[model samples]
Target: MSCDNCETALENLYLFLDEEIDHASIDEIQAHIDSCSSCLTAYDLERVVKALVSRSCAEKAPEPLRERVLYSIRTVQVQITENRGI
Candidate 1:
């Protein structure tokens, strides 16, 4: 498999990690990462960080905090509407 340049592969690294890129791009990035130790290390680090963040954010906020945030958002919307005369 032909290898992609480090810059291009790293540029799409986040998209690759998030699975947001097309299959062809994924293959290209994978090939680059496989052959390039620097990019492979970077990919591994980012993948771990992403996984950790995802896992950490998996917990739901407490019900009271959620309600308070929603209430604050509604209050802001109302104030904005009043100011705009909408």
Candidate 2:
């Protein structure tokens, strides 16, 4: 693969990993990764990092915390509106 292909593949790495791009784009990236060891390694690293972050942030906020946050937001909105005389 040429450096241009590698650069393009790197730019779309996250989209490829997330399957957010079109099928043709996915095939193109996969082909590049299959032919380029460096691209493959980079793709693998990104995949692992994405998985780690997804798992780490899977838990939901506690109900009390959620309520407090909502309350704070409402308070702020009210204050802003009042200040603006809206």
- Highest lDDT: give the candidate number: 1
- The C-alpha lDDT values of all candidates are 0.69, 0.69
Clashing pairs in 2: none
Tell me the TM-score of model 1: 0.62
lDDT tens per residue, model 1, 26-76: 998898789876676667666655655566588755667556555654554
On the 0 to 100 scale, the lDDT of residue 1 in model 2 is 16
| lDDT for residue 28 in candidate 2, whole number 0-100 | 91
- Report the C-alpha lDDT of model 2 over 1-86, residue by residue, as the tens digit: 13557668878988888889999999999998898766776676666556655665887555675565556545544553454353
Candidate 2 segments exceeding 4 Å error: 59-86
In order of appearance, the predictions have TM-scores of 0.62, 0.63
